[model samples]
Target: MDRLEAMAMLVSSVEEGSLSAAARKLNIPVATLTRNVNDLEALVGTRLLIRTTRKLALTDVGAEYVATAKRILEEVDELERRAAGEFTTPRGELVVASPVQVARLRVLPVVNQFLALYPEIRIRLVQSDRIIDLVDVHADVAIRVGRLRDSSLVATRVGALRVVTVASPTLLDKYGWPETPEDLRELPCVVFDSPSLSPWRYRSQDTGQIYTIADVPRLLVSSPDAAVDAAIDGIGVTFILEHDVHEAVIAGKLKYILQDFEIEPIPVHVVYLSRAAMPAKLRRFIDYAVPKLRELLAEFGRIPSA
Candidate 1:
């Protein structure tokens, strides 16, 4: 038996709680898993598992061996990868996740360009609004917008999005721009559905204080994209990320309002689990992406940190 392969199979079997599951994960037959494990037990001269019809439980010796096996396998993998010049030559599949619109606007272009430079790297992008547990989802990296929750992952702040209040040129011309937060209550308003946002909690640069807008929604939308569209059609003034309407703002269809009174911009980040020796694929991607993201979003974003 290949002792290293047996050790790996035994570790997988114990963790998975079944030989069948381990076999499925490793893409090997259950018989092969059984044969290797039996061989491993014969070599060690002890029973490693207490197996029944439905479940497999680890023996005392098996538990200790599994722990040691995992550490040994990790070291072996690192040694082999390094020996093959993997640290210098990036070649592997990268799994990444991001919210839908952000993925399309922020991440997709960067990934597309990256594929051109490294033909060996394949990308699998998972788009969802729900925050995924990187370890559970088996994702290698993620693009995070807004404030992040507590996590052990390494977060590199890329830039700050200009989440400013905006209105159509026609509405501004017809009604004129409001001078104070209180003025918004009397004007047509667009309300977006989000938990983190509060109509009252905004930094007012004009007064150098947090200002509360007592405005009620003249129109409510589920998505920020919809709010921007409503504002462009002369519906009402709405708070939106500047990047979403970068082209329209330049085309004079929409106008940014209360620049001096705009609240603090939200942060954007790229987050991943740290490793002792980082893989070339992940390291190179981060190096290639950070500056490009800063540059691409320069028109509608601010780099809060160097």
Candidate 2:
């Protein structure tokens, strides 16, 4: 049996969750994949997987073996890429993950310009508000906001985003300005139902105490853009990242309020897995894109009104 080929099949099957799915991805027959995995188990002297109608579950031994196999496969891939001059030449597909709004407003423009500059590099931009696992998705890099807790990943902070409270000028005229955090009780609020920013948090400038406002929302929406629109239509006040309301604020559709109560700026970052032999494509994109993003955030992403 070709040990490396069998290892590759086993890893693919484990990741893809089924032999048939892995076979399809590897472009081989399902029977062929099964044979390779069975042969591998026979050679290793243990059953590696618990095959089921719904899915494949790894045995304790199988899990350990698969982890080692992945590392070996990655080392081999790196060696092959180095041999093929990919380390010297910046040419390959690069997968980048980012938040939806950041990608739409900031990262997309940089990606467009990067593609024109580096003709050989291709990028797959994955936009999501939820956190994406780099290893699970095989992403080359990601744009991240807020604090990062993953010790395994490396991060380079580009800039910061402020969380600001805003309302339509019309809404403010009716409700009047919120002079203190306690004053929000009198006004209607549009809540963007994200766990990170929910309950409407604020920081005191004088006392330095953090406050949470838990009053019932006038409008509840899953998306930040929807909440911003609702706020602009004079529905209610919404607290969101400056990136979401920057344009609307400039156009006079929205106005910043409770400026003293806003929290510290949330840091934005370019992140990736720690690699010993980082690919040239990944390196080039980071080098090219980081400065452009920093400039964008510095000029536009900062708290504009104050």
Candidate 3:
């Protein structure tokens, strides 16, 4: 058996979750994928995967091997790029991942401009709110907001985002504006359910104290887009990144409130896995993208009354 080919098949199988899925991604027959994995297990003298009727599970050893195989593949790709003098040309596929709402509202337009400038470079945008494993997902770069706990990855702060309390004009007319954080409990509120079960958090600008709303939400949503829509329809007040709701607020679909007690600005970052030798394509893309993203944020921040 070709050891490298078997290793590739094994990694693909693990990532794709089944031999059939790996075969589909690799453009090979399922039988061939299965055979390669079996050969790989035999050579290693251990079963790498625990096969079940429904899905494949990796053994502890299999998990370790997968990590190693991924690094090996990345190194091999880097070597090939170096051999082809990719460092100078800035031409290759660049895969980026970001939250869907942010990508649609902020990054997509900038991406279009980037593409127009560098026609030779190909781009793939992956929209997901969940934190993706950069290496395993084959993502060249990621745009993230809020506090980053992953110390393993290299991060560059591109800009900051402020959490704004927003509601519709109709809701404000009926319920009246909240004068303080304590007043929020008396009004209906929309809450995002993903990060935490709690309601909006804020700091007292006068007393320099932090507080959280423990009141039950009139509506709970799992996505920011849903929260924004609910607020636009006057369902309830919600908290979202100012950049995400700026346009709606400007158009009178939504209105901003509680400016004095606004949540602290969260840093937006562009993150990537560290390597001794970085690909020119990835480097060029970041260099071109970061400044533009910062400029976009600055422009948004200057929008009066948003």
Best by lDDT: 2
Q: Tell me the TM-score of model 3.
A: 0.92
Query: Which of 1 and 3 is ahead in TM-score?
Result: 3
Over 4 Å off, model 3: 194-199, 302-306
Candidate 1 vs 2: which has more TM-score: 2
- Give every collision pair in model 3: none
Over 1-306, each residue of candidate 3 has an lDDT whose tens digit, in order, gives 888888899888888888899999999999998998999899999999999989999999988988898878877877888888777777888899987777987789878888898878899999877777787679989998778888988999898877888889899899988888788788888887744224578888878777887888889888888888999888898887887688798898988788878766778899998877777778888898899888887766634443
Tens digits of lDDT, candidate 2, 78-118: 89989988888999789999998889989999999999999
Give me the displacement of residue 255 in model 1, in angstroms. 1.6
- State the displacement of the C-alpha of residue 237, model 3, in Å, after optimal TM-score superposition: 0.7
lDDT of 2 at 156: 95
Which candidate number has the best TM-score?
A: 3
lDDT score, residue 173, model 3?
90
